[model samples]
Target chain A: EFIRKLWEGLLVQSKPPLTSHFPFPAQIPPDLVDKLERLALVDFRTKQGLECLEKAIRFADQLHVVDTTGIEPMDSVLEDRALYLREDTAVDGGCAEELLKLSRKTVEEYFVVPPGNIPLPKKEERSSMLKHSEL
Target chain B: MLGLTLKEVSLAFREGRISPTELCRKCLNRIKKTQHLNAYITVTDELSLTQAQESERRLQRGVPKGPLDGVPFAVKDNFCTKNVRTTCASRMLKDYVPPFNATVVQKLLDQGAVLMGKTNMDEFAMGAGSTDGAFGPVKNPWSYTEPYRTLAGPEADWVIAGGSSGGSAAAVASLTSYLALGSDTGGSTRNPGALCGVVAFKPTYGLLSRHGLIPLVNSMDVPGILTRSAGDASVVLSVLQGVDVRDSTTVPAPSSHAELPEEFDVRNLCVGIPKEYHALGLSPDTRAQWSRVADLFEAAGARVEQVSLPHTQHSIVCYHVLCHAEVASNMARFDGVEYGHRSSMDSSTEAMYATTRHEGFNDVVRGRVLSGNYFLLKQNYQHYFVKAQKVRRLICDDFRRVFASGVDVLLTPTTLTDAARYGDFTQEDNRTRSAQEDVFTQPANMSGLPAVSVPTALSSRGLPIGLQLMGKALDDHRLLAVAQWMERQVGFPSIGVHDDYRQCSDTSSTVQTSA
Candidate 1:
């Protein structure tokens, strides 16, 4: 008899109330999706990208109904313990060659990237531009 | 030998029954034979043999490093290994080799553990199913049928090895390696561990150093251990858990919890069965196994009670928000600057950056990055990111309140069901499937508690089903002790090697070889 009751109790406890699904924004605007693409630095301008974003947003919307008024936002799980600190020291240097070896394009000791649109002021104006920015 | 635990194999090495070189050769042979499983991304044949030879020399001298000495193990490709490619199963890093080893990998190698290979995983460890890698999808060993072995193509129906640590779980399950290192952000390790019939352990956050782990979520990611038994998991954890200057989040002192109690008594244990774990979509077999295990604890003179963690249902939603927000920030490093795949579309720097990311990342990774940036937008930051963090506190408080109420641990199903068919699993988008698959396992990640998935029984369909036990923060040893006890009682049958391959392994004489 106790076993039967235990089984029944197990069955009863297994069924918790389903998470309430509150209605969320039906669709994220395309402009907002474009902005997200720019910020993330990924091309999400396709149909598939928009669909993926919409699904993720809808899934995350479930958290909005949670009431967290008095609770402080948790940044790290180890907030209770003090993080370990060591004396400020320089170590693991002299690996510029090794670091440079990993890059596909390198000029001398520096990584090579495509030229930027910002035209460097003529060599004569470079010092003046720096001075102006500092001022 | 492949069927044995790390301790068992280590004992054999001490007894001089088998040498480390022989065991490594057998593992390499087995890995070769089971290539169809798509478990490994890169096999370090030369490195493994060389390491094995060194271990053999040490064994001959009658001086061993530790329990892991001469044991063969695999690592998930996400952890950087010096001079070896660590792809994280993404094209962005397909040909990229690291200049330094991850602290965890270095620690294991320092103990003389042989590195068999690097296993496959979801690209950048982003998805729930291991089907999203650039190389190919990993098929579950349990679901590999006779006909499919000969007839199956990439599109053929097969069971999924759960991800993002699917390859590690499959490797351990398939007996190709004694143990494998996996990383768990939410349920990446335990989800696959349950499906693959192995012990998957996620230590308390900050308990294990995460240096060079290739962060998925910096705040929640922990180096996970996957082995055939709880005892082996304990042995591996003892070697890897410590403070490292490379990762500042590590706890200051070495964890004494790595040492298991000499004798564990369940009579003194008070196990809490969190009622909220009995959530929707939990299969009948999973629920039955959960209850049976609870009954086993009660029968053994332990107090079993129902506890309510009201914030459990909100964890998945909260995790999505935080995970996406962090991913957006962390993934910003891969802009074709120094390492990783660089695009040749160098018309302009901005064009090059966008093109490189678009070509390098898959749809799922790009989707998360996009949604992550959306959540972090100035206007929506408070609504999504800040709100989720506050809800995260509530989730953490739920575990705290339960533990404070004299509960030694909480027992829940590791996954809602057994391993699913690739055809059926892919029916839903990766994001939807991950949310559903990770429901039970993510809460512990949220709370920063120690959790282990112990395979308890086979479902009616002949697939593995595991139950999860979560202990309070830093209570890893006791938690694993209980899991070890449960493992003994259950005696879950692990996957066996093929008879033909077993015969071949037995007859092959050990050869002294150098790479």
Candidate 2:
């Protein structure tokens, strides 16, 4: 009887299905994919990458049925408690040399990177570079 | 001695039955013998020996630090260890070493716990199965076989150690280490703990300091303790839990310590079995064990009641949205500029960032970043990210409402089924597997409640199955007490390297009478 109640609860829901109200795109459009690539600084031209994104979007569509009316968005789990703050003070600093040692390419004290405006490596070239690095 | 629990080993150390150095050597030797498990990313042989010698000297002086003194423990690779390579099982930080130890690691070291080494994990704790790691998948010690030892090729098939703390779980199960630290973000620790047959505890969110833990989802990630017993977990938790200025999220330590009572009075307890947990895809064995345990609670005078957490169905979806959003923001710091893998391409800073991320991260990590960015996009923020956050409130409220109704702790299955083969697990994408496996465990993370997965029974396949007990925020002591009672009642047989080769033909007779 207990198990039956559980099954019944699962089948007979209090809320209506909201799938029609919010029609999520079946596939992530190419332009949006390009935008995501730019925003995340990742290349998602492959089929697998696009599929993962589309699946994620489809999965998230389930939330539309949740009637979150007047619900304040919870940013942290400790929303009920007061977040303590410490007095502003420099606890640890003055280790620029040690910090600089972590980087691969450094010019004196600063990290060295190529100047802006240079184009990205081609797809084939990027793969080859990765392969070479692996070796 | 190698198979003893942390408490037992500590007791042995105090009684002079086993020296810290001898125990450390035994652990190191076991780790070496079980190399095929791929549980460790790096073995701190010299460092561990030196620490063990120091512990021996302290024992000689009768000035041991605490219960954890001289016990060997493993840290997940995601936690920073000064001068030791801290890889999140990613090529990105393959050679990168931190300048300081994680606060949890430092606390354990201060307690005189010998650090065995860093355990392998999912690349950035992103995958449900440990297979996403760059080093290799951590094979379940329960699935070890003679063929696995002889097999030289990578083509050998084996069961998976669930992730992203799969290596820690595997290490504890295999007796390579008595206790290991795993970071749980959306069931990473509990799932592996369930699969690998160990006690995995994820305390309330702010209880343990996450200062040096490589962030997966900052709000949900907590340093997980994986051990052979709940008592061991409590001991480790007592030492590790406290407020840290380094991490503002850390809460002040509770007035009482986290020690578990030898027995709990079930008559005073109300065990809530959330009906929503009886969802589809739950294995027959797991469901039976769930029912059996609920029955046991009732028979033992506890008021085992059927409760409803209506918002449970939407937790996984809500979790994915929030997890990806946080992951996208947290992962932004990994650009090749500071410390980690750098692409040779220096044509432009942007190009370097792009190619470096592409080369450093695996497909699963990149997918999350891209999807996270999409959700965070201005046009989609309100629809996706904000909606998920609102739904997250409902999920948290579900737990709050149930606990408010006088339910001491909620009992649920840690995973839908037992460990799967590597081939079977990889059949689905990382997202799907994670959604299915983490369904029951992630709700606790979403609500910031303390949850512990206790190995309760062996599946018909002879793999261990764990059940989770979740308590209200800051109620870890009672939660652990209940869990320890359940542990004593079950007497679930733990696995060892020697028992791996036994044919699992009969499930009924395989249940051990003693722990």
Pick by lDDT: which candidate is best?
Answer: 2
Q: Estimate each model's TM-score.
A: 0.92, 0.92
TM-score of chain A of each: 0.72, 0.68
Question: Global lDDT for candidate 2?
Answer: 0.85
User: Residue B179 lDDT in model 2?
Assistant: 93
Candidate 1 chain B, run of 10 with poorest lDDT: B506-515
Q: How would the docking of model 1 be graded?
A: acceptable
Q: What's candidate 2's DockQ score?
A: 0.48
lDDT of each: 0.84, 0.85
The TM-score of chain B in candidate 1 is: 0.94
Off by over 4 Å in 2: A1-25, A117-135, B145-157, B500-515
Instruction: Return the lDDT, model 1, position B257.
Output: 56
Clashes by residue pair, model 2: none
The Cα error of candidate 1 at residue B347, in Å, is 1.2
Q: Over the stretch A3-99, how does candidate 1's per-residue lDDT look in tens digits?
A: 3465576567666544534466448775675566556777653677777777678778788778888889999998887898877998679999998
